[model samples]
Target: MSDAVVGQVAVDQLLEVLDLKELGPFRFRGVSPRVGPQRVFGGQVAGQALVAAGRTVDPARLVHSLHGYFVRPGDPTEPIEYQVESIRDGRSFSVRRSVALQGGRTIFFMSASFHRQEEGLDHHAPVPPGVPAPDDVPTMADRLARYPDRAGIWAAIPRPIDVRYVGEPGWVAPGDRPPDPHQRVWMRIDGQLPDDPLLHACALTYASDLTLLDSVLSVHGEVWGPGGVVGASLDHALWFHRTFRADEWFLYDCWSPSASGARGLATGRMFTEEGRHVATAVQEGLLRRVGE
Candidate 1:
């Protein structure tokens, strides 16, 4: 009946979706929430595949990087099977490749590398100047609420991560404004998670895709809507630089360095509340308009 109650329920369901069921030693089963979509979200599959790969590895190794490709749109009506390959185990590093299958066809696959933490040379780029704190921003719901008629679709879906935009969301029309190539948002999981470092990495993987490519659209002043524009991620890569938790708010500063050949590239850096640069990501997507 209350908004808090409804919000809590949605988060509990998201956590359940993240917890994959192991069917065998090297295989896992994951399901997507039936959130009024014919296809499942790509981030969910990536995170699940990473989980499968991490499960096959020893706890001593933490995931430092993963590169994955989206092969096809996932069918939301069925469960996805993840098969992990243990590629190699070195003295200090391990490698694994995970494939997500449905109907006996591979829909997505990823290669992940893990490492045992060790002391080494340490330095990082500082947080960008004049970035507003996450607490001072408006929630997505509040922004969507401003456009009463167009808010229903976004309102009906359940969000596993809370994202606070530093400026206007790219989806909202910015009248008479020139195209901008930068996008910034603060994100955190909807609920608390376990102390597992691998889970944190997977959670960040899921969160990373939320708005990285939107920087591309922002540069063209294109907002996704009926007959407006369409886009899908082709490939994604992430490099973990330091330790961070998914439940705590992290600043994602992103920019579109280039967009040509009908493909746009966007990159992002993740910073912790204490200003530690924890991760970086780059994604290229097929961006085009409807009926083009």
Candidate 2:
């Protein structure tokens, strides 16, 4: 069989693994309900947690920011319990706090804010110049061909989104020189998502965790290997800029400001092809070298 056919097959399988079901208030049960090798894929928890928060909001409003922490590794085999706290309700904004629990233990906690649309002062940092356009980049599947040895990680990537790095290409083979603290990538879902703005926002939150944290590794001259480093996201925070669709191609520009004492901090912004700032994110993670 051709590599393209094989690649497509792999992506289909990944999407199945990520597709989960709503079981209760702010809670979800995975389609398979089995613990993945990482205890839990942080993205799944983040996305479902957002869904839980979204349920409590007025549909006319949109979520503008969500801050969360991974308190403990989740038990993927059991249904996660999400507890939402209504922090405040105002004319223009509403706040909610959600706690994800399993085995009666706190696994993740998040605070999200919703907003009624209104005009405001508008300005932003311009999208940097000299970066390759999304159209010119190779898809993740194309990059996977370089690492026949770690086929599992390649296959683990979901099919609906195409990810291509515009900077810092490594992990399979470390480059002659490491990437700078900053990196950029282009991505978009391969299929159409529902028009529900909340759903699209939650989906974007899921994908946001993809490579934003990895940019921090560049500062240490490290590359993410399938088995080399012990890594996990500790917390995530995102501030939405305005209405946007994640199903369309957007450029994610990432940079790490600091890393110390086994933790690394990174920040990123998602921009539309025309360079509108859609959202911004910050993530801190445990970045310990494995077998140290």
Candidate 3:
């Protein structure tokens, strides 16, 4: 199959996963991809939980911020049930808490707030200076070609996002990448999406998890898997500052602020290709060497 066709198929699958089955009011069900890791991807749970919360809210209100915790590893073979609590609703703001459960155990939970668009003070930080355009960076396929053995299971997974890295990725062999404080990349959905703003936001939520944690590893040129470090996201938070499309190019500029006690914290800012700062994300994860 052509690469474009494969990409579209992957994106369609992602959309299907995000489209949760509404069991009843404030309750929904989501399933993982048939072919994926043994543990569910954290981004999928966060995005699905957001979808559940969004469905119970007023469409006029756009999600402004979300804070989520990964309480336990999710099983990819089973379905997940999401319950959303309507925390509050006011003239201009609404809050919802979403909990994901499997086997009656809470695996993940998130608190998200939505805001009605209104005229108010507006400003955003400028995009980082002297960064290469998305088109100038090497594609994931291009990079993987140089490290075929390292590709491992990732090569079999469908890529719904077209990512172009500005610096070395976390999957690279140790010593291949020089220590760099900043980890930047340009990315966008691999296929076209409908014009629903909520879907766009959810898609960005999924894409956000892909690389934010890599900033922590890049600081010391550490890679994932054996002979390097293994990690799991403990918590994640995001703030949406402006409207943007998931299908268009955006820069994800990330850096690590600290790493201690076997935990690493990373912060990232998203800017449109046109230089509009649209979103920010922060995450801290448990990072430990193999067999530790």
The prediction achieving the highest lDDT against the true structure is: 3
Error of 1 at 281 (Å): 0.8
lDDT (tens digit, per residue) of candidate 3 on 172-225: 899797899999999999999989889999999999999999999999999998
Q: Using lDDT, rank the candidates from best to worst.
A: 3, 1, 2
- Cα displacement (angstroms), candidate 1, residue 69, comes to 0.3
The candidate 3 region of ten consecutive residues with least summed lDDT is 1-10
| CA displacement after TM-score superposition, residue 222 of candidate 2 (Å) | 0.9
Tens-digit lDDT track for model 1 on 154-193?
5666776888988667667546224776888999987777
Q: Rate the local accuracy (lDDT) of all candidates.
A: 0.85, 0.75, 0.93
TM-score of 3: 0.97
Worst 10 residues of 1 by lDDT: 1-10
The better candidate by lDDT, 2 or 3, is 3
TM-score of 2: 0.87
Candidate 1 has an lDDT of: 0.85
Give every collision pair in model 3. none
Count of backbone clashes for each model?
A: 0, 1, 0
